[model samples]
Target: MADENAEETYDNFEKQAADQAANLVEQLLAALPEPETRNKPDGGLNPVEAARRQPAPQPGFDGTIASFAVNHDVLVPGLYLSRQDGDIATYDLRLVKPNQGGYFSMAAGHSLEHLLATWLRSSAYGRQVVYVGPMGCRTGFYILLRGMKQAAAVSLIREALQAAAAYNGAVPGTASTAECGHVAEHDPAGARQLAETAAALLKDWTAADLVYPA
Candidate 1:
């Protein structure tokens, strides 16, 4: 009974810490100055114009990315926060490790993109789903949502990936599709195999999966 009490105390302490972290972020964001609404008259900023005007966060890095801060050698699959603007949050839904020869094959990634994007945009949570697409590095996808919680983002991606894992329909963009241009390159079987592997990894996510390793 003492051990059970200890475990309950530990759980409550953990929840308090998580709540404190969330409150800190809320305070920090509230302290920032208002964004420059360069192109609007009603004090509203167009997201596209704001994105175009903001200075690159890491100009000297490759592609002006802050990714240099990450040690790709130890990178693992998980939903890492990429950027947040107001309520929109973009997450790196990484499924493969980089610089370790675990990158996705072209056929598999393409099919996975089609399947996951379709599922997310049409799912019950579609109202919060903004965009889903493959990354240039061929490692995984970028999923954008309309909220800022890491736990909720991870849950949504896991559900989407699970759907993709069990998908057996005619892969969109395949030759069988009436509007497909590169139909011969599609691989539904390869896509399902990779999604199953990715879904397994996501099932056992840790805090390390929510942030980039430095």
Candidate 2:
């Protein structure tokens, strides 16, 4: 009887989670701004064309750091460019709160990583994708984009959080005996906790002193 009750509860949770995910996607789509349309003058160059014509000189401070420091820290988290290199950009996504213990069970982080990578690669904004992987410190994940002001990737972040909220469900690519190799397997409980924290952060994130390249 106890087992049966537990199974029933899990099923109900799955249903509720699916409904919530759909609602969140709707809200995000509604909040997105309409894209602007510009008429190109016959002789005037488009931004891309202008860029092609300019000499490949050193980038400004913000652009320089954003382009080269994929493996290095740019003092801030969310987004940054490396001052030393102008081609690398980074997207820092924290998986655990700072005050909380930094240790994430390997299973938990790895599982969450898989889910996030899958979602981001397939998201509408995937074209901007560069790299998606866990941070070396195990406290968070890093997503590198190909260009500056790559705010479009934030939508993928939102979708990842929604997917994380459905942690109880089976994670794709998680059950491979040969693939996982027992290197700290994925933990759904930990993934759910991290996901919730990330979701709250995203909702509250604003253009205050918190972001980079002010």
Candidate 3:
């Protein structure tokens, strides 16, 4: 009876959390500005005028990328807080050690991206997840979360990776060309292997380990 009661309480908590997250998202969407309505005197946008009004492009990838300043030579395989903007926090899920030749293959990274995103979006904190994608460096991936505690984010990543590692079915969002642009490049086996490796590496990870090694 106690176990049953505990399960019931936990279910209620999860439901409430989901409902609150949904309400917040609805409010944010409602607050977003409507599509640009500016038009030229002729009732059509002028490409030349629009181009002139745009901000000048930076030399290369902006002058202030926090990740670029990170010393990759000393960076190890672990989770690190990349940056924070307003309510969102970007996390670096480093799967492979930096400057090592053990980088994930293209197929492996692509497959893992699909698997990780799918599993994460279906987790308890799914509503907090802003985005999930592979890093250009091929050493790891990035996950953006909104208003999440560091401990909860760490827990979410660990559990999601464990789930991905054990996953044995059709990779989500890769059923056909209609679903994915590069459908032929997925490798479930390779993705699972990567997930397994990452899961083990983060088995004991905690919020305290979130900082980049100095």
Candidate 4:
């Protein structure tokens, strides 16, 4: 009887081992690749090689005063400050969007413009609010300076970014009749994100010589 009991125990162990092996095989088959396969290696082209062959997009115009012709019929070269009554010493921040066939809407760019301008003017660096508006080509904005020193805009940009990061104030001109285009209420979070990106870009900008007509 002891020998028969030992034989039964061995049989049980062998059955369990066989069951486990079958389960493992089933799992392996489930994880195996499908029979259908593509003939092309790497789906046709190598991603790294394709990327290396791709041409990069061209850069936008730098809007420098020197790029324009200064013929007698052309306007004199000077910085035009935004929203100023009569200031010839600064560059004007012109709104170049919202026109027919423009890329960005006037409403969207206007809100960001208002937030940036208001923040710059009210913050500790309010004095550096030279120009703040969109570009005509709907690509990006332009900032003209009373002086060529990049340091002039740096402080204000820093203050503005910190404020935006901790933004609590309403976007100016959104509710009042003085509204430029749109309000920051539409997307406060998105506005802050955009401000952070702009701040990062501004950090890399270096000041160059401010050349004016003599």
**Candidate number of the best lDDT:** 3
Any runs in candidate 1 off by more than 4 Å, and if so which? 1-63, 173-178, 206-208
Better of 1 and 2 by lDDT: 1
- Alpha-carbon RMSD, each predicted model: 20.1, 25.1, 20.9, 20.3
lDDT of 2 at 124: 66
Candidate that would win on TM-score: 3
Q: Kindly list the per-residue Cα lDDT of model 1 for residues 1-214, writing each as its tens digit.
A: 9999999999999999999999999999999999776766545656786677777776463564555556778888767887777999888878788877868888888889888888887877788888888888988888888963677677778887899899888886564647565666677888898889888888977435677766
lDDT of 3 by residue, 64-122 (tens): 67888998999999999999999899999998888788889888889899988888888
lDDT of 2 by residue, 14-43 (tens): 999999999999999999976444564434
Model 2: ten consecutive residues of lowest lDDT = 76-85
Q: In each prediction, how many residue pairs overlap at the backbone (N, C-alpha, C within less than 3 A)? A: 1, 15, 0, 7
| Clashing residue pairs, backbone N/CA/C < 3 A, model 1 | 175-183
What TM-score does candidate 3 reach?
0.71
Better of 2 and 4 by lDDT: 2
Compared with the true structure, all predictions reach lDDT values of 0.79, 0.64, 0.90, 0.53
Instruction: Give Cα distance to truth, residue 47, candidate 3, Å.
Output: 39
Off by over 4 Å in 4: 1-106, 125-128, 178-187, 208-214
| Model 2, residue 8: C-alpha shift (Å) | 99
TM-score of each: 0.64, 0.53, 0.71, 0.42
Which segments of candidate 3 are over 4 A away from where they belong? 1-62
